[model samples]
Target: MERIELVKSIEANAERILEDFTEILQYLRSEGSDRCDEVQNLLFATRRMVDLIDSALEIYHYLIRLKYLTADTQRSETAESRDRDKMLEEMFRELNSNLGV
Candidate 1:
Protein backbone atom coordinates (compact mmCIF):
# COMPACT_ATOMS: atom_id res chain seq x y z
CA MET A 1 0.00 0.00 0.00
CA GLU A 2 1.03 3.60 -0.52
CA ARG A 3 2.60 5.63 2.30
CA ILE A 4 -0.21 8.17 2.19
CA GLU A 5 -2.79 5.43 2.49
CA LEU A 6 -0.98 3.95 5.45
CA VAL A 7 -0.67 7.33 7.17
CA LYS A 8 -4.32 8.13 6.56
CA SER A 9 -5.32 4.77 8.02
CA ILE A 10 -3.21 5.43 11.10
CA GLU A 11 -4.66 8.91 11.51
CA ALA A 12 -8.19 7.51 11.38
CA ASN A 13 -7.35 4.85 13.96
CA ALA A 14 -5.77 7.43 16.25
CA GLU A 15 -8.86 9.58 16.04
CA ARG A 16 -11.06 6.60 16.93
CA ILE A 17 -8.92 5.81 19.95
CA LEU A 18 -9.11 9.43 21.08
CA GLU A 19 -12.87 9.31 20.76
CA ASP A 20 -12.99 6.12 22.83
CA PHE A 21 -11.14 7.85 25.63
CA THR A 22 -14.06 10.25 25.96
CA GLU A 23 -16.46 7.39 26.57
CA ILE A 24 -14.04 5.83 29.00
CA LEU A 25 -13.82 9.10 30.89
CA GLN A 26 -17.57 9.41 31.05
CA TYR A 27 -17.98 5.87 32.31
CA LEU A 28 -15.38 6.42 34.96
CA ARG A 29 -17.09 9.60 36.05
CA SER A 30 -20.41 7.76 36.36
CA GLU A 31 -18.80 4.98 38.37
CA GLY A 32 -16.97 7.30 40.79
CA SER A 33 -14.88 4.44 42.05
CA ASP A 34 -12.77 4.55 45.19
CA ARG A 35 -9.79 4.24 42.89
CA CYS A 36 -10.07 7.88 41.88
CA ASP A 37 -6.32 8.45 42.05
CA GLU A 38 -5.57 5.53 39.77
CA VAL A 39 -8.35 6.57 37.43
CA GLN A 40 -7.00 10.10 37.30
CA ASN A 41 -3.55 8.81 36.43
CA LEU A 42 -5.00 6.64 33.71
CA LEU A 43 -6.93 9.62 32.35
CA PHE A 44 -3.75 11.68 32.24
CA ALA A 45 -2.02 8.89 30.36
CA THR A 46 -4.92 8.72 27.97
CA ARG A 47 -4.69 12.43 27.31
CA ARG A 48 -1.01 12.05 26.62
CA MET A 49 -1.69 9.24 24.18
CA VAL A 50 -4.23 11.37 22.36
CA ASP A 51 -1.79 14.25 22.18
CA LEU A 52 0.95 12.00 20.90
CA ILE A 53 -1.26 10.55 18.22
CA ASP A 54 -2.37 14.02 17.19
CA SER A 55 1.26 15.10 16.97
CA ALA A 56 2.10 12.03 14.96
CA LEU A 57 -0.58 12.91 12.44
CA GLU A 58 0.75 16.45 12.26
CA ILE A 59 4.31 15.23 11.82
CA TYR A 60 3.18 12.97 9.00
CA HIS A 61 1.63 15.99 7.34
CA TYR A 62 4.84 17.95 7.85
CA LEU A 63 6.72 15.11 6.19
CA ILE A 64 4.37 15.40 3.29
CA ARG A 65 5.04 19.13 3.15
CA LEU A 66 8.78 18.60 3.16
CA LYS A 67 8.41 16.25 0.18
CA TYR A 68 9.47 13.33 2.32
CA LEU A 69 6.02 12.12 1.46
CA THR A 70 3.88 13.02 -1.53
CA ALA A 71 2.82 16.63 -1.80
CA ASP A 72 -0.56 15.52 -3.06
CA THR A 73 -1.26 13.76 0.21
CA GLN A 74 -2.12 16.94 2.21
CA ARG A 75 -2.57 20.43 0.87
CA SER A 76 -2.66 22.46 4.08
CA GLU A 77 0.59 23.54 5.69
CA THR A 78 0.54 25.71 8.81
CA ALA A 79 3.06 26.51 11.50
CA GLU A 80 0.43 26.05 14.20
CA SER A 81 0.41 22.28 13.87
CA ARG A 82 4.17 22.15 14.15
CA ASP A 83 4.04 24.35 17.25
CA ARG A 84 1.38 22.11 18.77
CA ASP A 85 3.46 19.03 17.96
CA LYS A 86 6.47 20.57 19.64
CA MET A 87 4.42 21.36 22.75
CA LEU A 88 3.20 17.77 22.87
CA GLU A 89 6.80 16.60 22.52
CA GLU A 90 7.85 18.83 25.40
CA MET A 91 5.19 17.22 27.57
CA PHE A 92 7.02 13.92 27.17
CA ARG A 93 9.88 15.07 29.36
CA GLU A 94 7.44 15.60 32.20
CA LEU A 95 5.24 12.60 31.46
CA ASN A 96 6.68 10.13 33.97
CA SER A 97 8.12 12.67 36.38
CA ASN A 98 5.11 12.71 38.67
CA LEU A 99 4.47 8.99 38.18
CA GLY A 100 7.83 8.33 39.81
CA VAL A 101 8.80 5.71 37.29
Candidate 2:
Protein backbone atom coordinates (compact mmCIF):
# COMPACT_ATOMS: atom_id res chain seq x y z
CA MET A 1 0.00 0.00 0.00
CA GLU A 2 0.93 3.63 -0.37
CA ARG A 3 2.42 5.57 2.51
CA ILE A 4 -0.73 7.55 3.20
CA GLU A 5 -2.87 4.43 3.14
CA LEU A 6 -0.51 2.63 5.47
CA VAL A 7 -0.56 5.55 7.89
CA LYS A 8 -4.34 5.58 7.84
CA SER A 9 -4.40 1.90 8.72
CA ILE A 10 -2.06 2.50 11.62
CA GLU A 11 -4.14 5.39 12.89
CA ALA A 12 -7.30 3.30 12.66
CA ASN A 13 -5.68 0.48 14.56
CA ALA A 14 -4.48 2.90 17.22
CA GLU A 15 -7.93 4.37 17.69
CA ARG A 16 -9.50 0.93 18.00
CA ILE A 17 -6.91 -0.09 20.55
CA LEU A 18 -7.51 3.07 22.53
CA GLU A 19 -11.21 2.27 22.71
CA ASP A 20 -10.51 -1.25 23.86
CA PHE A 21 -8.05 0.00 26.43
CA THR A 22 -10.59 2.38 27.87
CA GLU A 23 -13.16 -0.37 28.20
CA ILE A 24 -10.69 -2.74 29.79
CA LEU A 25 -9.58 -0.10 32.26
CA GLN A 26 -13.15 0.48 33.31
CA TYR A 27 -13.58 -3.22 33.84
CA LEU A 28 -10.39 -3.42 35.85
CA ARG A 29 -11.57 -0.64 38.10
CA SER A 30 -14.90 -2.26 38.88
CA GLU A 31 -13.42 -5.70 39.40
CA GLY A 32 -12.84 -6.76 43.02
CA SER A 33 -10.83 -9.67 44.50
CA ASP A 34 -13.70 -11.90 43.58
CA ARG A 35 -12.49 -11.47 40.02
CA CYS A 36 -8.80 -11.04 40.62
CA ASP A 37 -7.61 -13.80 38.33
CA GLU A 38 -9.95 -12.83 35.53
CA VAL A 39 -9.07 -9.17 35.91
CA GLN A 40 -5.39 -10.01 35.87
CA ASN A 41 -5.73 -11.81 32.58
CA LEU A 42 -7.74 -8.98 31.06
CA LEU A 43 -5.23 -6.47 32.32
CA PHE A 44 -2.42 -8.43 30.69
CA ALA A 45 -4.34 -8.47 27.44
CA THR A 46 -4.96 -4.75 27.75
CA ARG A 47 -1.30 -4.10 28.31
CA ARG A 48 -0.42 -5.93 25.11
CA MET A 49 -3.07 -4.00 23.21
CA VAL A 50 -1.72 -0.74 24.58
CA ASP A 51 1.81 -1.68 23.60
CA LEU A 52 0.69 -2.45 20.05
CA ILE A 53 -1.05 0.90 19.79
CA ASP A 54 1.98 2.69 21.14
CA SER A 55 4.29 0.96 18.66
CA ALA A 56 1.99 1.74 15.73
CA LEU A 57 1.70 5.40 16.67
CA GLU A 58 5.44 5.70 17.09
CA ILE A 59 6.13 4.17 13.68
CA TYR A 60 3.47 6.25 11.96
CA HIS A 61 4.74 9.48 13.50
CA TYR A 62 8.33 8.57 12.61
CA LEU A 63 7.30 7.98 9.01
CA ILE A 64 5.54 11.33 8.93
CA ARG A 65 8.63 13.06 10.28
CA LEU A 66 10.81 11.25 7.73
CA LYS A 67 8.62 12.60 4.86
CA TYR A 68 6.95 9.30 4.11
CA LEU A 69 3.59 10.77 5.14
CA THR A 70 2.59 14.38 4.76
CA ALA A 71 1.61 16.42 7.83
CA ASP A 72 -1.75 17.59 6.52
CA THR A 73 -2.84 14.22 5.18
CA GLN A 74 -3.90 12.32 8.29
CA ARG A 75 -6.52 11.42 10.81
CA SER A 76 -7.55 13.77 13.60
CA GLU A 77 -6.34 13.12 17.14
CA THR A 78 -8.08 13.27 20.48
CA ALA A 79 -6.83 15.62 23.22
CA GLU A 80 -4.76 12.77 24.60
CA SER A 81 -2.38 12.79 21.63
CA ARG A 82 0.09 15.17 23.19
CA ASP A 83 0.23 13.17 26.42
CA ARG A 84 0.67 9.96 24.48
CA ASP A 85 3.53 11.44 22.46
CA LYS A 86 5.24 12.65 25.60
CA MET A 87 4.86 9.24 27.26
CA LEU A 88 6.28 7.50 24.18
CA GLU A 89 9.27 9.84 24.18
CA GLU A 90 9.94 9.03 27.81
CA MET A 91 9.65 5.32 27.10
CA PHE A 92 12.23 5.57 24.30
CA ARG A 93 14.53 7.53 26.55
CA GLU A 94 14.33 4.80 29.20
CA LEU A 95 14.90 2.05 26.63
CA ASN A 96 17.91 3.87 25.14
CA SER A 97 19.44 4.21 28.58
CA ASN A 98 18.88 0.55 29.41
CA LEU A 99 20.20 -0.83 26.11
CA GLY A 100 22.98 1.75 25.71
CA VAL A 101 22.54 1.48 21.98
On TM-score, the leading prediction is 2
lDDT per residue (tens digit) for residues 2-75 in model 2: 66666676677677767767766665666556667777767776786777678677766656664634443433
Tens digit of lDDT per residue, candidate 1, span 6-101?
667667756766666665566555644468866775777677666667756765664555464455444335456777888987787578676665
Would you list the clashing residue pairs of candidate 2? Answer: none
Which segments of candidate 2 are over 4 A away from where they belong?
A: 33-35, 38-42, 45-66, 69-101
- Candidate 2 local lDDT, residue 69: 40
Q: Tell me the lDDT of model 1 at 33.
A: 47
Cα shift from native, residue 84, model 2 (Å)? 45
Error of 1 at 43 (Å): 0.4
- Range of the 10 consecutive residues with the lowest summed lDDT in candidate 2: 68-77
Clashes of each: 0, 0
lDDT of each: 0.64, 0.68
Off by over 4 Å in 1: 1-34, 68-101
